[model samples]
Structures are given as structure tokens and as C-alpha cells.
Target: MNITVCNPLLRTPLSLIVDDSCPVINLTYYWIHQRHAWKARHQPNIAPERWEGDTIQLKKIPPTIPADFAWEWAEWCWENGVKGKFSLIPYPAGIGRVDEGFPDFPTREYQAWLRIYRELIWPSFDLTPEMLTHTAVVDLDTFTLTEAWEQVEWVDPPVDNRLTDYIIIAMEMLDNVGIPCEGVTSPGAFGKRQEAAYARAVLTASQHVNNNPRPFYFLWLKHDELPDVPIWYPDKEKGVAIASIVSCAGDWFGGWTGYDLGDADRFITEDLQGGCLPPILEKELPCVLVGHWPGFYFNGEKSGFEILKTVKARLDAYDPDGTKTLWMKNSEIGHYWMARELTKLTVMEEPPQIHLSTQFPTANFTLALDTPVRHIQVNGWDLREVHSRRDFQTDTFLVEGKQTFVAFDLEVGKTELELIVA
Candidate 1:
């Protein structure tokens, strides 16, 4: 019998990745001024035009996004079933530690924001630290931040131990605030050049802090020709791995600064003939949408959030019943990918059985077979066959036309699926 592994419930996976996100701090507003200072201290005096410009644009943008705005966004995602990754800058621009408190904000205000994040956002979103500081790299010994940007430090050399230590510190900061991280989001192409070392560091730190054997990161954003699956960095001998989750679409909702107002049509047109998502879905790849935290605020316009709403509405129109798409958190995607890649499946014609040896346990695991089946037994336990895909669940199988789909809670070790052909 010919068999294939399919996406959860045979539907395409959809996820989102937000960068430069923090609690109350608007990264765009801070980074602009901070970059100027860092560059001025550089030996070659490498400063960009944007850094040289006065803070005149600052008048239009707020210094902080505020807790109320964050609450509004969090509530929307909760009601809409939108799930993905969110970054928390442990020490945003070296301004303050999240576990401690920002110098500018009152202690009560900072604590209130943390409560909002830990309670409302933590449940639905995979919390990740975008390095220790989004702007400058911190010297652990001195507890002082270097003049070099975090991105520059990532590309400098192959300092595996040092990098791992840095990641541990970032993860620890979040952990101290009771938000454990299973992965990390690179800040401004951080670890782009040294991906292997970066992945190792991420896995080490994540496992050390959260005890997650499988960790993931979001670094590369490909506007075109996006990857259908995560690029894996595995250490099979140690039974630990990391997923380099790639963002397929551009930050079209709003720019990193929330200054550039992007059109929703770039993601999905009103007519549905164009945009990046349709093609990604057509290819049966995960439409990992990309955005920035500041952009969602749209400099207090909330225009970026509006764009997201339109895009979600258009997507809902595209898959009205949710039969065609499966919404997943970034960590869930990483876990599923790990199981998909590591699981060993064997078919035997003697008694019509399919054996699965999975390294990682995953939920809503689905398998497809060309043959029709009247009954299925998972290691001698009879699986209940569902009539429809929507009704499919753990230890349940569905037969649609000439294909047979099996859904189950995939567990570690060997699972034998004995089939009775129709």
C-alpha cells in the first residue's frame, strides 16, 4: 500500500512571525537614536542617513506603544484564533531589564504590562527573546553593553560558547519574568552568517532553560520562493534539534518603524487572484506571514492592525470552513516538522500493517494511504473511523473517496497500525 505523510488534517499550515516586539517599548523609536550613538563610537564612524537625521520624525511616533494598545491587539488575536510567535526584548536597547523595570516607566505600570503579557499573550503565542538587547550586544562579564549592534556581533566570529552564553542570558531574562522561551528571534539579521553556530546556541540555551529538546528560531525572511518546510539542524546522536523557521512574506502589514503604511493587497488582494499567500497555499507550503511589532501600532494609527484584519478576512473568505488551512503556532510547526523528519515508517504486506517509530510526540498527526480501509488498529486498539475530516481526532481515521486518512496522537517509540482493507 502506498502511503504519505500529510499536514495536519490534510490542510496547509499557516503561521505568523513578528519581529522587534517588546513590552511597551517601541523599538523603532529607540533604535533610530541608539544606532546613531553606537555608530558615532565606531572607529570608522559608520552611520547611515536615517541615523544622521534629526528626531523630527519622532514627533509622529510614540516612544512607547503602551499597555492598552498591546491589550487590544492581544484580545483580537485571542478571538480570531490567530496563533504565532511574539518576541520580548529582555533588555530592549540596553534601556532596562524586563525582569527588573524600565527606568522611564513606573514600577506599577511595568509590572501591569508583564501581567498582561504573561496572562493574555503567553497562552496563544510562542514567546521568544529577540536577543538580550535588540540594539547593542551586552558584555556578560562587565554587565555592560558594547557599542557594536547585536547584528554585528552575530556575524563577527565563531564564538560558540560565548554565543550560547549570550542566548542563555536572554532566555533567562524571560524565564525570570515567568515567560519561558522555546526559541529565539534574531534581531536584524542576527546570526544570519553563522547559522549553524546560532542554531546550536539556540538549542543549548532553550533546552537548558525550558528543557525543550526541540527548539526553533526565526531569522531569514524570504519575500519570494519561500521554503515549504523548516530547515533542520539536528544532533541525532544527542536526540536534540533546532528548526530555522523562515518567514515567507514581506513585512507588508506595516514597516519595522510603523512609519511605512503597507497595503493589505500585497498579502491577499480583494479579488483573490494576486498576493503572496495564494501561491504559497497553491504549493501546499506554510504561509508564514511576517510583520513587526511597531508596525502593528502604525505610529498609533493602528493601520497595520487594520491591514492584518483585512488579510485575515480575505483568508477567511478563502478558507471559510477552515478545512483548507490549519493555524499553528511557530513552536507547534517546529515540533511537527521534527516528528515528520525523524519518524520512521515501515510497511509490511504479511498482515497489512504500518509501523511508526517516532522520535518526537506530536498532536493531530495525520497519514494518508492510497487504499481504502474498513478498520484500523493502533497496536491492537481499534481506532474509531470518523465520517468527516472536521470530526477527525486522535485514534480516528477517515475515508474519503479512494484515499484513507488516519489521525492520531503520535507517541514516542513504536506504534503498529494494523489495517483491514475494504
Candidate 2:
């Protein structure tokens, strides 16, 4: 009698192809410039003399304690393959106008702060105007703002150009300060309108300022009943394509509940592994986590900084070679994911080549193989020795190699590739 044994290794596909969804640290600036305002409101007696002169001098004002916290957090991101989206709210509260309580633009003090941002903060992170003052629209002349309740109402299916105007203003401010304002993230809440004016405003601003379309990374909570996918606003006439990505985690600051170093570990082992990875792997979506600077520095001890470092360590351990996990700033990830969605992918079995044609030629994609790859060719040209990882499954009867992972870039137009298995 003749018996045959099935090879589990043979049953697996020669290569596993999937899109990469990188993790992002979405840090918001709510109180970066609000300390004076908070003091005036709570302890009026000790507040700094209200600056009545047109020229406010902030050069003498030392960096806020929170600025150090921010620097420390950014340092960890730089060291560890982590990227961040820092929301820059130019005016906090009591720093700008007397009545309306907005910072005066072009003031010497304001310029000093901008210089600090350009020199110190801008290098490590991508900046977003978290909406001027992060509150209601203010009248420069009257020194009054729109109703507080109606401030962020533009988010509710914005139909008018109010949000667009705000975005343009914010972009102009960043440009004046020499900060590249590539995207926008809404403050917090919105109303019930279905038109999606906020997203349209972001795209319009990007085209007007940067002369290109860009994606918006919105603050999304886990409990929010929204799909974790790129949201595209359909406008075929002008050929505007923009997407909104929902954040995967709640605010790192104890918004729902304070998260510490241990919480950071749980976020990776439980929440990220169980909640984010499944959807990303199954649906090919980006997994972005959002947090606020105030939340992380709630205790003034830089706990959030530690949490960020711990999260990076966990991610590094999960993918030591850094081939499987893609770490990028939120804006970069948004643009890349949008490009991947728009691109067309085709795989050939005979030559074992993957073909990608995309408007975005520089987008990155990963290819996983069951057998060791000898070499890879792109567009019929030989690529330099590519990095790959080997996996193995052991059993009592046999120890078989599982898969090898490879990452490559796809250029615009037809990109032909060939993979030789060793």
C-alpha cells in the first residue's frame, strides 16, 4: 500500500501581498499657548499685565514648561521609528486681542513664537493648524467671537465656505511663519450635515497653497460609529480627490481614561493587535492613533512621553527588521494610503511578478513569499539586493519555512517585476 503526505508549506501561497497601514502619533496642541489665559480666568490677581500696546514682547517669555514636555515626546519619536502629527493652535486664549482674546498676528511676540516653532518643533513633526485659536471665529475689529456653541459646527456636513475660509486663514498664517501647512484636523465635534464641507475645504486649501491635493487626518474615537477607511469627497469636474482617515485609539491624555506606560503596553498587545491589525490586515486600512499633549502631560511629569516610547518599543519588537510595519507621520500615511487605494495591482503566477500602475509612483508596498527570494526585478530592471525576513513553523515530523517578507516601491505607469525563489 502506498501512502502520501501533504506538505503544509506547499499549500501556502508563494507570496502574500498586502498594503501597509502605519501607526501615527496624532498629538494636538490645546493648551500650548493657553496658560496665561487660564491664569487670567482662574486667578485674575496674578495675571500678567494685559498688553495694550500693538507690540507684545514674548522674546522675554521663557519657553513654557509644556514645551519641554513636547520636546521630550518628539525626541522619543525621532529615536524610535515613530512619526507624529502635531496640531499647532497659534493662539491659546488670553494672549492675542484684549476683548476677543486672540493672539495678534505679525506681532513681535507672535513672530518670536513662530521662530521657535520653525526652529525647534517643525523639524521633528508635521504641523496642522488646529483651526485658528481652536475655537469660534473671532472678529478682529469688534474683539468678539461667534457663539461658543456654534464654533465647530462647520463639521456637521458643512455646505458653505466658512470652513474653507478658516482653513485658508490658518494656512496663510503657517505660510507666513514658514511652516508647511499640508493638512487640517478639526477641533473636536461637528453638527449633522451630510455635505462634508470640511473635507472639501482641506483639499481646496492644499491646492491653493501647495498646488496639490492632500488628505485630512481627523480625530476619530474608537466608539465613534464610523468605518475606519479613507473618506473621499466625490468631485469629478475639478478632479479633486481628498480622503479623511479616522484615528484608531482614543486620546492618549486621560480623556476617556488616563493611559500610562502600562496602558501603552496594553494598547499594543491588546487593542492594537486585536482591534487594529485585524481590520487593517482584512480590509487594508491605515491604523492611526490620536492623542493630546495635555493628556500626556496631565501630571506635568511627562508620563505620555514614556507611553510613546513604550509603544515604539512594542512596535519595534513586533517587527524587528522594520519591513512589515510602516511608521510614518499621519499626513504621509494618509497620502500613501490614498495612493495605494487609487493604484491598480496585478500579480502574475508564471513569472511570479507583481505589477502596479498608479498615479502615485512613489508609494510603498510589501510582498511576502513562502520561499526564499533570490532576486527581484522592477520594470524589467534588476533591483539591488532587497531585504527579506524568514519565518518557520516546526512540528515533530518536520520543520518547514513559512514565509519571507519583502518591501518595494511602485513607480507611476506600468511597473513590471520578477521574483526568483531560492
Candidate 3:
């Protein structure tokens, strides 16, 4: 049977291919990789007795467990059949405590890792959220080699744990080796920034990455934060939508802020769990998975083939009828290489000649790209933005104190969006 699905944003119907690619899941590792490494011995060095570190525990996993807390979360994602992968963006600030136990600089392996991130990882992932590194070992001037060894053995952090670039590298490696991957982020990169990124992504997508039919996502294409992102997507307090500068998930209540969804959220929650994703799925907008934990790294390899299992679980729940279209996660995306290799999905698209504008309180406004874009959003209400803009072109967007979604295209006529917040 021809699987022709209706495109919500485009208002057209299109045939979809076998939906092999999983919806993007940003963060897999909740606390740290140690949990997965503890007891399980994903590696020889991870044996229980050998386990020696003050690690983080998954939020839900109780402190009483005392074991590798992160593992439980990984297991949760794995069990859920969610290919929720974590990015390797390092919070060097978190290193203060980790470094206290070490004698000094990292060993040769770590040095090699540093080089890999700088040379291969960074370029590969096109990472954001800059990382800070400290690769120095301090030795006691009066201590002998044996004494130094006794006091401090080795200082080695996972390549991915130390950087987001490594996370991309690992995901890319897995994709190269036939492993399905997804990338995630917290609420940080979700809202307004995501909108701009999507705009940029669409702009880049229309170009057809390196002559490839798919899209190309340059991590740092340009900082949308250049002017200042706004909180227009979700309103948290209203039990519905609010400001969304950059948000991972758009459910105002279910999102990061932890506000209870009144009616709309209830509807979406019911839709997702009921195995009938919201009609919102019809929108062409590429939504992001926001609830991800950082610190899952890979060596261009995915061990413990659990990705498919997780994917099945989410698929079974997210799209029982197989109508919604999803995009790959950030980490799983290496210069949008995965985007190119992914199966040809049957999502609908529209001509990229429209703009979706949202107004802020004080003469401030936000805008999105669309072609003859419809303005159905209820201002000061639902955290609404353009679902998807199929018809996009190359042009500079302008923003002032309030974020503006400018749609640029070298088309027959000049297309624009102006948000006059009154």
C-alpha cells in the first residue's frame, strides 16, 4: 500500500518511505558514563572492584543505590527503546572535583584524546558550548617515582566526557559502522536558538549539503544569540505556550521548567503516550528532543547494540500509525552526514517563501521563515512558531533588542516579517 501521509504545514500529501530513522533523543547518559561502565565492564577496566570514582547518579535513580547511577538511566533509555544519545560537550567547570584526585596532567592516551578533539572531534561535530582543558600533572618535588605512583596513579577522563566534539565523533563513528544514532540537549539549546538554528538549517538544507540532496547542519553556522534570544515558545505559567528562544521540547508544562500542562499539554501527553502523536506532528517544523544529559562519549563506535531496541520502543509509542516525521539528533549528525545517509522519509514540505512572526511584550517581536506562512498563532498564548518552512533561501536575518525571525530569499519579490509588539 502506498504510505501517503498528509503534510500539516505544507497542506499537501506525500508518500513516506519505511520509517527507519528514529526520532532524535538528545541525552542518554543521565549522570555519567561511569554507571554504564561500573560492574558491567563494558570495558576491562570497568570491573566492580576496579570502580573507583565519585560519580553522578541519574535523577530518578535513588541515592541509596550507590552504584553507577548513570547506568540505570542508560538502562531506562535502553529499556524504553529510545535511541536517546548524549553529546560529548564537556563542562570543564565540573572538572574541579574530578581533577582533585589526580596527581597532574592526563596520561598519553588523554593527550592523544585532546589532540583528537582539537583535530578530528571539533571539526567533525561542529560543536557548540566551548570546552576548557587542563592537561598538566603536578609532581611532588621531594617525592620518588614510587611514592608519586602511590599518591597519584593516572588522570584519564573519557574523550567524550571532556568534550562535545568527541560525542559527535563517537556518534559519527557509529553511523559509519552502521550504528543508528540520535543527539540531544537540555532546555538550553531548545527554544529561540533552536528556531534560529532551524531557520539556518533550512537555509542550509535548501542548498543541499555539498551537492547532496539532504541538509547540512553546521554547528556554529552563526550564533543566533548574536542579538539576544527571547523566551517566546513556552509560557510555563499559563499552563500552555510561552516565550521560546531555544527549547528542546515545546510542551510548556512537560518541558524543562516543570510546569504542569493544563489542557494542551494534557492533550499532547495523551497523544504521545496514547500511541497517536499529536496532529502537531503534521507540521513541517523539525522539533528537538530537549531532555538530554551530557557526558556520553564514543570512540567512533557504539557498543552494546541497544540503539535499535530503544528506537522500537519510542516508535511503538510515538507513531503507532507512522504519520509523524522526525529528524536526526545533533550528535548523530556530523556535518549533516547522517542526514544524507538516512532513509528517504515521506514528510511533506512547502515552498519556503513565508515568515511566522511572534511579538514580545515591549515593542519586541520574534519571527520565523515560511512561504506564504499562515498566522494562526494566538499571541500571548500558545507557544507557537513556524512548524516548518520548506521554501527557504540564502539571506541575512536581522534582530534587535527583541529577537526577529527574518526570512531571506533571492526570489522574484522581497519577502519579509515585521513584529510590532503593542
Per-residue alpha-carbon lDDT of candidate 1 for residues 16-114, written as tens digits (9 for 90 to 100): 787888876788888887766656666445536763333567668777888888889989988998888988999998888998899887776687689
TM-score of each: 0.95, 0.66, 0.29
Of candidates 2 and 1, the better by lDDT: 1
Candidate No. with top lDDT: 1
Rank order by TM-score, top first? 1, 2, 3
Candidate 3 or 1, higher lDDT? 1
Better of 2 and 3 by lDDT: 2
What digit string (tens of lDDT, one per residue) describes model 2 on residues 1-422? Answer: 11121212111111100010001111212222343454456567874443211113332222233334445555555565465566665443324421122332334433444444566555555677666655455554464654442233445634566656656766766666566665765665542253356667678887887676655545454544434546476333333467565665544433311222235743465344653334443343445666655446534555655665566566566556543555555565555555555556677777677666666533335444555556766666665552222331211111125444444454556767677766
Clashes of each: 0, 6, 47
Each model's lDDT comes to: 0.83, 0.48, 0.26
What are the C-alpha RMSDs, in order, of all predicted structures? 2.0, 10.6, 17.9
Query: Model 2 lDDT vs. the true structure?
Result: 0.48
Local error of candidate 3 at residue 239 (angstroms): 44
Query: What shift in Å separates residue 251 of candidate 2 from its native position after superposition?
Result: 1.5
